[model samples]
Target: MEKTTRAAFAFLLAACAPGVFAASSADLSVTGSITPSSCIPTLSNDGVIDHGKLTAKDLGRVTPTLLDLAEIQLEVICEGATVFTLTTFDNRAGTSAINPAHHGLGMINDDQKLGSVAFTLFEPVADAVPVKTIVSRSGGARWAENAYLGHEALTSFAAADGPNTPIAIEVLNARLRAFTIIVPARDLTVLDEVPIDGQATLQLKYW
Candidate 1:
């Protein structure tokens, strides 16, 4: 009887050992290609839009004040012909007095919202050929002309013949226009000198 009991215990241990020690495995794949061509993007004036200064008298009391339009030159040069897109990120996010699609101008006293700015691309020239500005909200799947440049949209230049398709180019030049609007004076505290702190990043991506 002792031998039989010992044999039964050994069988139980053997059956449970496989279940406890068994390992499950999965495979992971890391794959991507490095392109030989690269592109460099630069903006005129070091990408700075100085609004100088603003006083309470310059701002509106009940309506939003519209500042003068600002224009900046954008250039993208590539080692070789390459397809790319341009996007923007609002550094002062969540501080825009207008809609979220617009870039923020920062806040006052860490509570009161300041203003907003909207960017538009115009007169794009790629490889010395005139091209139109095309934008895609669906991650390059589809593109259209005359779309607003926002954080969620991708901006690219299309050849004149191909109105909605992006083309590879060695160089691109475009005008970036910014329209700014300040919040109403009634919604802000103008007791002190408040700086119009607005910053944004224009990013380039390979397609």
Candidate 2:
């Protein structure tokens, strides 16, 4: 499988200050790194991963116990006003063309759902736009996890069966720019490394 590249960059924006420094705009910005590749490292379905019990031998396999895995961590900052829609795809299903809640629109896990893969957006500040939609593979409302207006510095959700999952994020306002990290593996316990080709699109809606 082909390896994905991980990278990071810092962006700065100038904005007017509201206080004593009103004469000039302040340099507003967010700093972070894009670790595209890291071990997703999954634990046993019923046990903790840290114990290191999930291995080929445990599953009656004769191969070595070392599992190949990796993960992608993307850090982004919205300097000012903006909105975004983030979605993912499980290769077992279709492409990003399908909505996030197609299979279900509630919690991450649902029996009707076929393959599993989920995406969560994290915002440090309370002013971030709530997740408007979490489309699924079946093209219907499957889950409806409520929004945490406050008291949550960051929000996140996990996905199972993500080997061929497609991750995507779309911003409502052109003011926001996005970054990505793509890992070469999923579910560390399985030890199966899959290759993924990442793509993006900025669709403008006019009505």
Misplaced by over 4 Å in model 1 are 1-16, 19-26
Which digits, one per residue and each the tens of the lDDT, describe model 2 over residues 1-207?
122222211111223334534364679899876433221211122211122223323332322222223223333333332232233333334322123322111211222221212233232222233223222333222323322111111222212223222223222211121222211222123335222222222121110
lDDT of 1: 0.89
Badly placed stretches (over 4 Å) of model 2 are 1-54, 59-74, 91-207
Residue 42 lDDT (model 2): 16
Model-by-model lDDT, in order? 0.89, 0.25
Considering every candidate listed, which one attains the maximal lDDT? 1
| Model 1 per-residue lDDT tens digits across residues 43-141 | 999999887887799888999999999999989999999999999998998988887889999988889999999999888899999998899989999
- Per-candidate TM equals 0.87, 0.22
Residue 111 lDDT in candidate 1:
95
